[model samples]
Target chain A: DVKVTQSSRYLVKRTGEKVFLECVQDMDHENMFWYRQDPGLGLRLIYFSYDVKMKEKGDIPEGYSVSREKKERFSLILESASTNQTSMYLCASGQFKEQYFGPGTRLTVT
Target chain B: AQSVAQPEDQVNVAEGNPLTVKCTYSVSGNPYLFWYVQYPNRGLQFLLKYITGDNLVKGSYGFEAEFNKSQTSFHLKKPSALVSDSALYFCAVSPASGGSYIPTFGRGTSLIVHP
Candidate 1:
């Protein structure tokens, strides 16, 4: 089974603080994606990594960045957490078409 | 570019009755369609995929989807609905033959199973 694990299921941060969401996959998939889900808007991709150290910006990449130092781990960084950044973040990994997702992390910024 | 659409914002169905969630797509090449279900506050779960030959694809939790080539539609269907089956559903599509495999996802459709 392909297992994707997120560092946290829930998170809270103050405004202007930095936040990090971690995701690790056991299947060693070459592609990793980070997305923030909002009501009515669906899943909008924030970033995706095709390979180690290679990253591409998705549709909405305004205040977020990604790091892929290894094949199994991908991290999303919030430069300065804002209230608008509070949402459910999802991480997925896949080599081709079918991606495996982690539980997700609900982030709250106050 | 490939794109997916889930026209209905929400679907209402009674338990034990059949349910269908509509999905349409456009792709430059042969299409690879996928259906995913998302529980509240959780990431999406893979339900099924139509990669090639089979038009009717069965998936987890008794859910199935049919891929129609002429109409360019892939709709998720279930013979019986359970209250537990209520959730948000997303449809995605990617080009099957092209070099690009990145998928475009629909906004999503919320399914509500009435008791």
Candidate 2:
């Protein structure tokens, strides 16, 4: 079984604070993704990494950036958190077609 | 480009009754369709997929889905519903013929089963 684990289940941050959401996958999958899920917007991809230090911007990557310094870890970074960034963040790692996801981190920015 | 649509925001049914959660998709080429279920506070779980061969595919927990290429629809169905089946259902689509590996997911339909 592929296990994807997120660093935090819930996080509360203030405006202008830097936030980091970490994800680790045990399956050693090469592709990793970060998404923000909203009520009716479904899951919007924020960023994806194909290999360590390589990244691509997704549909919604304006307020976010990513780091993949290690094969098993992917991190999402918020340069300066804002209230609009409050949502459930999901991390996934897998090959094509099937993506194994972590439990997700519910972030609340004040 | 690829996209998935689950029109209904919510669907309600009684236990032991038949249930259907609708999904439709559009892609440049033939698609790879997928259905996933997400319980409250949990990550999405893969239910089934339409890779090829069978129009009707069965998945975990007695759930099944039918693919209609002409209609561009892949609707999930179950003969009998259970309270535990209630969850957020998502449909996804990815192009099959070398377009893109990443998939597009629907907004999700919340199913509520009455006991």
Candidate 3:
């Protein structure tokens, strides 16, 4: 079975603070993605990495950045957290057909 | 651009009754469709996918989906419903060829099963 693990299941941060969400996959998949899910909005992609050091902006990429220094790990960074950024973040890794997901991190910004 | 549509916002069914969740899609080329389920406060789980070969594809948890090319629909179905089957269901689509594998997801339909 493929395992995708997120660094934190829940997190709280104050406005204007920096936040990081980490994801690691044991399958060594070439593609990794970050998405924020909201009610009525579904899962909107924030960023994705096809290979180490290669990143692409998804539909919504404002105020977010990604790092893929290694094949197994992908990190999402918020330059400065805002209340609007509070939401459930999910990480996924896969090649093409099926993508395995982590439990997700619910971030709260106050 | 590729997109997916889950027409129903919610579907309610009683235990032992059959259920169906409608999904339609639009893509430039042939579509690779998928169904996913999400429990409360959990991430989405892959239920099934329709890549090719057959229109009827079965998946985990006694779920199956039918692909209709003319209608551009991939509706999820099950023989009977269980209380545990209640969850948010999402439909996604991607181009079968000539595009990145990144899928476009629907807003999702909430399934409520009553005993």
Q: Say which candidate scores most in DockQ.
A: 2
Q: Write the per-residue lDDT of candidate 1 for residues B1-115, one digit (tens) a residue.
A: 7788899999999999999999999999799899999998788899999999879999999999999999999999999999999999999998988657878889999999999
* Residues B1-115 of candidate 2: C-alpha lDDT, one tens digit per residue: 7889999999999999999999999999888999989999888888999988999999999999999999999999999999999999999999887877888999999999999
Q: Write the per-residue lDDT of candidate 3 for residues B5-95, one digit (tens) a residue.
A: 8989999999999999999999998999999999998988999999998999999999999999999999999999999999999999999
Better DockQ candidate (2, 3) = 2
What C-alpha lDDT does candidate 3 achieve relative to the native structure?
A: 0.95
TM-score for chain B considered on its own, for each of the candidates: 0.98, 0.98, 0.98
TM-score to native of every candidate shown? 0.97, 0.98, 0.99
Clashing pairs in 3: none
Residue-level lDDT of model 1, residues A1-110, one tens digit each, is 88999999999999999899999999979999999999888889999999999999998999999999999999999999999999999999987688889999999999
Question: What residue runs in model 1 are displaced by over 4 Å at the alpha carbon?
Answer: none
After best superposition, candidate 1 residue B28: deviation in angstroms?
0.6
Q: Write the per-residue lDDT of candidate 3 for residues A1-110, one digit (tens) a residue.
A: 99999999999999999999999999989999999999999999999999999999999999999999999999999999999999999999988767888999999999
**lDDT (tens digit, per residue) of candidate 2 on A1-110:** 89999999999999999999999999989999999999999999999999999999999999899999999999999999999999999999988678888999999999
- Residue pairs with backbone atoms closer than 3 Å in model 1 (clashes): none
Range of the 10 consecutive residues with the lowest summed lDDT in candidate 3 chain B: B92-101
In terms of TM-score, which candidate is strongest?
A: 3
